[model samples]
Target: MNRRLFPLFAAALALTVAASPASAAAPADAYADEVVAYRAEKWQSAHFDDAEKAQKHAATLKKLGCEVKTGAHGGHTDVSHRCPEWREISLKTHEKAHQWEDWLKANGFETRHAH
Candidate 1:
């Protein structure tokens, strides 16, 4: 590593990072589109108190473009909003509840299963 080459190496690295896809941010419209797609179908986030209900709900969610797994998060159906892993929508705190409600309504969903 010559002293003169050090600056060139750094510049190359910066260029590489700038061109990398991971360095780019996902567009907000993309998230909004996915939310709209999720809302276009019947989306229900509820507790899987019954195994049968959980299975049915998972299947329904899968049909609506979700990648569902075979389990619950603390007795609730873990529905992955986008990624492959499942997420619990049941642990809604006071502020989280309002945010969830607002998000649902904004995405054209009713949040009908917030019991």
Candidate 2:
């Protein structure tokens, strides 16, 4: 390579690397962000009286583009879902979870805090 062209070659290489697909991909915290959103939504702390109800709730969350996991916790069913793409949705879900938890408690269903 000509010494006179070295700077130009370096600049081109830098631009190519900066614009590469790998560089443009989501940050390493992409999944972590989802988790954070899920927690902020309070979906992970929701409690149900039975597995069936928990599964149903999980299904509803799934329809909203969240991945849910339901299981028994402290003798009650717990439901948790992954983050949605929008923060607004997460906030909405959080409010919904609060209402659901309150209703469950009122209905004589035991509830537990998230782990």
Best by lDDT: 2
Give the alpha carbon lDDT tens digit for every residue of 5-101 in model 1.
Answer: 3233333323321111112342322212111111323433444456765565445344434545565667655433332222223222344334444
TM-score of every model versus the real structure:
0.29, 0.36
76: Cα error in model 1, Å: 7.2
Error (Å) of candidate 1 at residue 54 is: 0.5
* TM-score of model number 2: 0.36
Over 4 Å off in model 1, which ranges? 1-36, 39-45, 72-115
Model 2 lDDT per residue over 4-102, tens place: 332332333233211111223433222121111121233444677666656655554454345577779688887766442332111123333344344
Clashing residue pairs, backbone N/CA/C < 3 A, model 1? none
User: Which lDDT values do the candidates have, in the order given?
Assistant: 0.36, 0.39
Q: Give the worst 10-residue stretch by lDDT in candidate 1.
A: 29-38
